[model samples]
Target: MLIIPAEKSLDWKNPPWMTLALMLACLVIFVFYQGKDPRLLHTAVQHYLDQGLDRLEAPIYETYLEREIRLEGEADRRTDLEAFRETVAAGERASLAVTMLMDRPFFDYLLANRDLLMNGRQRQYWTEARVPIQQNLINEISAYEAGLVPAEPSLYTLVSYQFLHGGWGHLIGNLVFLFLLGFTVEKALGPGRYLLAYLMCGVFSALIYTGFSWGSKIPLVGASGSISGLMGMYVAFFGMRRIRFFYFLGVYFNYFRAPALAILPVWIGKELYDYWAAGSTGIAYMAHAGGLVAGAGLILLLGKGWFQAREAFHEPEQEEQDRQFTHDYADAMEALARMDFTLARKRFEALWRDYPDRPVVLEHLYQLAKLRPDLAEYRQRTRELLNQYLKLQQPDNLLRTWQEYLELGEAIHPLEAEEHNRVLFAALRQDDLKVAEKAFARVRDTGHRELVREAGRLLADEFGKRRMEPKANEYRLLLKTL
Candidate 1:
């Protein structure tokens, strides 16, 4: 089953650069520093192959083989050991040697016996060879330092760990969640506080992970902890609002809207179930649960007006106004449907007066004007609606208004020069020379010197293409004067 949140209740005016930077930082670290380096593992494999098993110290070899038996089990260990012996007997080609060592079972065999391969009689020959392989196995020296190891907790790892990820899939999954929930949280908390809260949530998550996995050496990494916190905050802030979600269950697919907070318990409950049912599968479900608890608590405190002077609350005035507009707009549309022109006009006018900035209200007004063009008030309303469309800079509305103007035989005097140019260009593209000519003339009359010059040049080009030298020359003269 696949379930994902669709959209949030809030809108952001600007792009979230801080969140973007964090993602970029993770990518840079993974690609440039960790993934690109190939020295250690490759070198160690090459060295072991060149020296051969006869050079190996006996005591170290026996101890190493025992460790391999314990780790990989006897049957798998025997299989890999035989493969290594066969590769050695077959003239030990460098390519075949590297391949054998790279295989997981064979790699573990070589790692366990690294000390035997590097020391005593072969010390000079294998010193550099053994160093890289042993270090790579024991330390995960290049990459794992950035992750938070609960067994050996560090203050630095608590925050830096969130920026590190296990693999491309891990990074991508975390980034997707972060973008969905982070932007909304940033918008709600504001940027500075949002960054602080994100880091704090990561720290809290790590603490929870440490408590749960105190004896485990595996390092916890990724941004899921901080992102979980954002989800928790989302529930606290917009719990009552119905939010749409897209869900897929095998072949079945559908969308449903539910109260925002309703998903929180489901998420936490799933994590709890997974934690117990799956045993330790490497995922830090405890950290996710901890982040959720921390975020909900923090947001609740902020709601009580503790963190900042301003309390986080919904705008009742705006909500009420929206509700009223929806009610009135529907009534106006219903009146128009019944062909009660007088009643529709009055209702639309009331809507226009109350919601001057609403594009839908102006649209309905324009529709009403088309129905009763004989009325002076209706004609005037058409002009007002056209002007409003221009102000809004909506291309569809501008084109519709232009069509309505032509149909009504109204002079396009009030249309802005930019919109007039757009109409001219659109007409030219359609090869509607008559409409283009009319639009160009209207734009020329506006006395926008630059637009008039541009129109003259375009007309000149069109005429020249048609082999009308005289008309083209006339426009060229007009352009030169401009």
Candidate 2:
């Protein structure tokens, strides 16, 4: 009869790894866009080469980089690199054209370079490009503010900010965390809501960061803002549940389960510590704080009692266990009435331990339990019964017997089987088969012999659809036994 609170009932079975994967993907793109420096470009080409992208698109990306270097400034020059850059950038649609041209001969290269271009080099590129990036974000926001699009914060920076990062360590750390947390949260919330939440959190965090650190000229990057949002919601919804983490150091590994709620205090403390230690050491702590709050609030709103009430109320499994006990008791009586000793013995044996105080019923049930074919402990039940009956004495035992019989027959008091069966028989005579079947089954299930026979006959005749041989034989057999 215990009821669990609706807010506490969240499906926290799986970790939010999907959200993390999404964050990684976003990280790669962010790195590429933000980390476009000569060293980064060289590293990207090397990575593409390592990944077997050289044959597909490495040459093309190299060519494009060379052209940019030539137009901007050249740090390194080697062999066919210059021609390759010119050829690729000369196309009508440089980006798509470069992609198409490279795909045929250097597909792997494109993928390899994709991580480099998207994630950025320590995001070493240039903060100047971020102006356009932020400007584009502001433009998108303006559209919404001007009523051209929905008032969605996600559109402002969620997509773009995922690619931004503080430095190599900052980028890698944020991305790794994002990949781990994003996937799971996304799956739990579902794609659309997860995507919306992620982007909104990112946008909100970015705005907060910009407001406090205005014109500081730091190329604010990293998925921490969005990923922090996921962590916040996770802790809010799953609270005290243990979350497993695998800590890694060079060639060593260890695991531990920490309460989900602990993440918030630790995270907040770290941000505060960092903000004080180095006032904005390539991390947007304000953004992370804002994102965490937003995520927790959103999940709470969604998990509210009213929202839960809109869905069907699902009681905890204990209710099912109770119903199972009741059902087994009912089934035991039905089996005993049909002389299905095998099933009855099993059910009564089960009930003996579960409801031992009902000794009047247990006397018969104890006898039935003793008849269990595979019972190795029947002797113990018999001794218990003898001891119980000894306590009842003559007068009390006789009174208990009459009380049990009255309960079994319903001839008096709680209106037993006598009148109920008559009513059932009358209904059967009038061909009100449904009523007859219900009443007869109800009485027969309690070892009411006459009622069982009547119900079986009516069921065979009226409901069995002209009685197939198997059914007729079964009914006849049951009737004969009764």
Best by lDDT: 1
Question: On residues 1-482, what C-alpha lDDT tens digit does candidate 1 reach at each position?
Answer: 55556544444456666777777887887676556435544565556655663335333444455666787454435554555556657755664545443433333445565565555656654445544554564245333466787777889989888887777898898888788777667766767777887888889988998998785556788888888887777676765677777788889999999887787778788788888786536688999988887777677677556333123334344566799999998897788889887898899889888778887887777777777555565556656766676677654566667867666644433556776787887677666767777888888888999999988899889989989899899889988787
Can you tell me which runs of candidate 2 are displaced by over 4 Å? 1-24, 27-35, 39-159, 166-169, 240-259, 305-482
What value does the lDDT take at residue 207 in candidate 1? 96
- Candidate 1, superposed: residue stretches over 4 Å from native: 9-13, 36-39, 44-142, 304-327, 332-356, 359-482
Candidate 2: lDDT over CA atoms?
Answer: 0.54
Please give the lDDT score at residue 310 for candidate 1.
26
Model 2 collision count: 48
Residue 114 accuracy (lDDT) in model 1: 53
Tens-digit lDDT string for candidate 2 (58-117): 445566556645884533333336545555566422333333322222333333455555
Estimated TM-score for each candidate: 0.55, 0.37
